[model samples]
Target chain A: MKMDVIQPFINSADAVLAQGLECSTAIGSLSMEEEAYRRKGVAAMVWLTGDIEGRIIIDLDPETAVRVASKMAGAELPESDSLVRETACELANQIIGNAITALNDQGFHFRVHPPVMHMSEEGIKSSEDTEALVMCFETPIGSVFMNIALRYNRKRHADAASAGH
Target chain B: MEQFAPVKRSKDGQPVRYLIVDDSVFARKNLARMVESFGGHLAGEAGDGLTAITEYDRTHPDIVLMDITMPQMEGIEAAERIVQSHPDARIVMVSSVGYQENIVAALQRGARHFVQKPVKPEVLYEVIKYVLGDDGAVATAAGAGV
Candidate 1:
């Protein structure tokens, strides 16, 4: 994916975290990972369809998830509550929402599926030929990581989307 | 303490009753908190668009904050259903989707306003006040957000 598409995700994360938790985030170095990194405490996955095909994964520890949920709810959330899980999903939704909005403004059309929650420990697996950019962020509550792997079929779908205008 | 009633009013003579509908519990709670912080009352809440319709009828809230993407039914359809029966229903879309298509669809479906998530508290306040036609001190209450 191009920086234009990827930067929106980064900016969305920054804006969402700041608004939801009033916490400042220090985004770590960005790296292209050959293999999918192991999953952490809680993760949310969102699929992109239409002009793009791929998934976005957001990973966070349970503690951080609880804290973030608590801040978002303006109340303390228990560790094992489903609300915490929903909070994680909504967080991912917001990030993807922001990204797609920017992408649309840049003349791209794509739709996102509802966020799915994964609470497993085996981590996420990346298939060969599908490269992903992994970025870790440090927040006051805890750390958050995002993995974005998407392929835009520029010739086929991009032209069809742009031609409609 | 006065139990918050349907279409509750604030001391400043503004209607603060609100019904929040979103599949995400986090979003519902966040919007509820923003409403309450602005001297508003939480008339009720629903998790999805289907339930939103029933809740709207039950609560008769002055304002409704809806999310576009949801299970059972989407916000646009629910807004249309609510507005079809109640022509003057004031519904505000609070969704992560900021696409022009979705916004236009929601407005066409009878949504009075649209606000993107993660919603800044100040923006939420101003939009709520603006939609309710109450552009008073509450609009500038929180200059910290947005």
Candidate 2:
């Protein structure tokens, strides 16, 4: 994926995480993955379609998910609480929504879907055309993982180009 | 959450009522907390735009906080529909998607304002006050009306 496409997600994650956690966050790691994704713990996935097409997943370990949920809730929550899962999904939603907002300003149009829990242990393998980029953000509470796999809609781009001629 | 001077209806001095619509329960809870801090009342809540219309009819809230992306219907269309029936409705588009196009579309369709998500209570408080305009009054610390 182009850096222009990926940069917004990275920036969004940093800003959203820092604001939500009420502390600074650093990029712990970044890498590309060709294999299928494995769930680290609690995970939420959001899909996008339009000028860009693909999915993004936000994953967190069980302990971190609980702590983050509790902190956001302003109260202690047990690991079994559903709010933990909800928190993960909301985090995904906010992160992706913010990222797409930036991309939209750069002239990309897309629709953001509501987040769903990535309950399965395994995810679809990345293809050559859309290899997934995994980024780990280190926060005061814990590590947050973002897996983004996106590709430009070549047909749409081609159509626009031809129409401009 | 930091408390602010209560925003009450200028006509009756009652707490301003609000309808919050978002698919995420977590987001709804967070917004609920923020509105409460501003001394506002949660007249109703909706998880989607379709329900938001119904809730608006049932609750008749003074203001509506609507999210953009949702399952059945999006926020902008709902805002338009609501405004079509009640021309005086005050709908504020609150979403993580705060692109200029989306903001402009919502405003043209009848949204009174737009607030980006990961919302700050102070920002939302100011927006609520601004949108309410002459129709809203801030209560003094001594419980006197503004």
Give one clash count per candidate, in the order shown.
2, 0
TM-score of chain A of 1: 0.87
Candidate 2 recovers what fraction of true contacts? 0.79
Residue range B1-146, candidate 1, lDDT tens digits: 11222222433455478899988877787777777777787899998889999999999988899998787888899999999989989999988879888899899989999999888777777686678663333333343211
Off by over 4 Å in 2: A75-80
lDDT string for model 1 (A40-142, tens) is: 6688989888766788889888788988888777677677767667777999999899888888887777877888886565556666645788898889888
Tens-digit lDDT track of model 2 for B1-146: 67899999999999999999999888898899889888899999999999999999999999999999998999999999999999999999999999999999999999999999889888999999999999999999887774
What's the lDDT for residue A131 in model 1? Answer: 79
How well does each candidate superpose onto the true structure, as a TM-score?
A: 0.85, 0.96
lDDT of each: 0.80, 0.91
**Which residue pairs collide, candidate 2?**
none
